[model samples]
Target: MEDFEILDFLELQQEQQGIDKTARFLQKQIQNGFKISIVIKKQHKFALAPLQQKKNDLFSKQHQPMDVTSQSSEQTENNDKQGSSTSSHSSVKMNKKLIIPPTQNETPEQNNNEQKSEKSDDDQISLYSKKNCSFEHLLKDNLLSQKIQTGLSFMKDGNQKMALEKMMDAYREGNEKLKQCQDQQQISVLIIICIQSLCYASQLLMDFGQFSESQKCLDKCLNQFEINDFDLKCKIYITKAQCNLLNNQYLQCLDNYNKALIQYEQINWRLEVAKLLVKISFVYALLNDFTDAKKICYEGLQILQSKLSHTDPRIYDTYYTLGCIYYLEKDYDFALEYLNQSKEGFIKLYGEQHLSIIRILNLQGVINHLQGNSIDAMELYEQIVCLYGDSQNIGLALVLNNLALVYLDRMKFKSAKLSFDKATAILKVYLNEQHPTFKRVEKNKKLFVAATLSYL
Candidate 1:
């Protein structure tokens, strides 16, 4: 009985040792697997980190507290469904939809700070968008707008050099901002501003006698803007035509003016069309197509007569052009008639002593001189000389030459020589020696001196 009892004790002890060893092995396996699972979870979160952060940022901007409990419940339900879908898999994977949970026990101050931060972020984004978006936005920005205003003020003050510098700087900055623009409406508005700037710049350049530069500016605008608006296109075409006219590219000028007229007609801009017709008449006169010039001038005058008062500037321009055409045709009677009508318009609008009146007076004097009325022509010339007031400009030079011619006609040898010398000096100072006016004055002075010597 003792030996049997001892054997039973040994078997029980061996069985207890085997059970202990099995339990330890199972515990080690569980520890290693838990560590591997933790590493895998960390790698997964790392891969999803940027997307999760973006979602969190969006939530923060909403100004509402995160519903952590509801999100957790939903995530649990999703995991159950996913687990059922993959029931035959060896292990269950956690759902990867990262829902950031709100922290509990947060102070009111912290929440307020978060809301303020979000608002500040929104404000910054909006500001950035405006600065890069539209011409109106730039025009609204006080600093940027001030640049444009300052440029205009400079131009108004007759400081074109400074105005151009400021305007060009603003334009360049605007162009850079335009490159960043994403919206089409913003692009259209910005383009309009750019075209306006170019137009103004071109006119300014023309005023400074920078004809080539003016043409360059217009070309830049034509290349840059694909304008659809009729008014804007008309403005561009007119500017281009003016530049061509100044360059003496008469055919090109006519073509551009006709294009602008077409656009004007589309909008029923009759007044502008009339003005364009007068300009086209002038071109025809320059080309020595007097018949067409007279026809176009009459067309323009008829249009003006219907819509404008007799004193309208368009009427003045048409009448003046008609007078010139008739004068070129050597029809002094018709020339005087049209010229008197033009002078009446000028006198009505600008009074007798005005420059416009002085110009018409010069033309009338030429007509009188041609008609053998030296006394009347001399009187007109003297009036122009008095209006000059010591200014040695081109207008003054032209009038002095005409005055000299009238003196020569009257056989006032001493007075004619004096006037011719003075006129020649003015021309030589302002104009090229090879200019026709200077050559004509020289030839006339020679003829006058020779005739007087021969008479003596």
Candidate 2:
């Protein structure tokens, strides 16, 4: 693909909430025979070179002498033959060789000039490293880069075990590399890689429902990496917030999300700021702080609507959160409106069978049930059962419970009992007996039994 096409692809993936997926997509394109480097080089200003190799190349060039007299004669000869020669090509060649350094046999003055040039190059490299963040080092570390690509490929292919294994190995290798580095700059680069590895590992763990493991990874990152760089620090807070959210620590999650939002705002990362606002609004919704959730969700929606495309998928995140908030507030009409929008967006981006679509569908079903549309609600709930049958996912337990409630509402006692029993079985596999979900299912079963006895 062309540079603009690749950029559009990244934008779309990002809108779909796939930040890390963008690079993996590019690698997949490369594997399919695209010359991605040419496109990347054309768009990015910096040349793609290993930093060490670039330094060595500069050092070697500092010792090669140029003959100014011959250069002058050649240029004069080229001017005479300008009409017959490729003037642009000759001038380019001359420009490229203009900075040749003094040889060992040159005068003492020339040797001093070479030393100054060498020092200047070193200074430039140092400055570049500081200003460019970790890109210089990331681009240079081929093995780390390759491991990341492989790990992500495994992730995309649904080999979660292999993916986690590869990513953990990458993390371990980064640690070893860190121990071998003496230069502060090299150490900084390796640490950046380590942080990146931890981020990926934590995200993977979270995806696999290993919330405790994910939290531990984030803690390790916080302990090892000093929070100095704006982007890295913001990401650390965001990851921690997600872990807290998963663990139902709403207040702690809110604190970290707000911290990340502040950093994003200070950096003028408008998209990230908008995204964090939506996330913080979610925490508010969970805490039943509807006023704050509504306010922040609308503000985030405005930012997204103003800055991004009409079709950008991030708009859906805000809409989904708003729907939940409205549902909590019993604003059923508005809840349905926003939830339908979210459902449509997910379907468009990931097709009907996507897990996210399943969630929106479930919420839509709940809304239908609350609105007294029993037939529609039952249809939606049955659709979920068909789509996610016996997956043992937490969402499946939720769907089953809701479906059981609908069955009970219809006085289908036997079906309700069976559905509640299925939910109880699934929840037991994933949660302890003391879990709230287990207690609720047990109560539901007891109530069903009592009602059946009364009917008998």
RMSD of each: 42.3, 22.4
- Clash counts per candidate, in order, are 0, 0
Best-fitting candidate, measured by TM-score?
2
Q: What is the lDDT of residue 193 in candidate 1?
A: 49
lDDT tens readout by residue for model 2, 1-456: 211111111111111111121111111113332222211121112232442242233223322212323322232111111111111211101113221111111211212112221222112112123335355645355487578668878766656567788878878997887666666555545555566667778876765556678888888877654443444556677778877776666566767776776655443455565677777766666555576567667666766665566666777767777887787666879988988998888788888877666766777776676565757877888898888854654456666766776675566777878888887786665555764445655665666565555445
Q: Which candidate has the highest lDDT of all?
A: 2
Judge candidate 1 against the unseen true structure and give its global Cα lDDT, from 0 to 1: 0.54
Candidate 1, residue 360: how far the Cα is off, in Å: 1.3
**lDDT (CA) for every model shown?**
0.54, 0.56
User: Could you give candidate 1's per-residue lDDT for residues 1-456 as a string of tens digits?
Assistant: 000000010111111111111010000012322110100011011224543342243222411222323322222111111111212211101122211111111111223112221222112111122223344564455353467667778776656767777766766765666677766545444444455466667765665446678888787766664433344456567778877765556667777887877655543455565677777776666555566577666666665666556666767867777887776666879988988998898888887877666767877886676566879989998998887677665456657766876776666768878888887786665445654445655766776666566555
Q: Estimate each model's TM-score.
A: 0.54, 0.58
Error of 1 at 66 (Å): 82
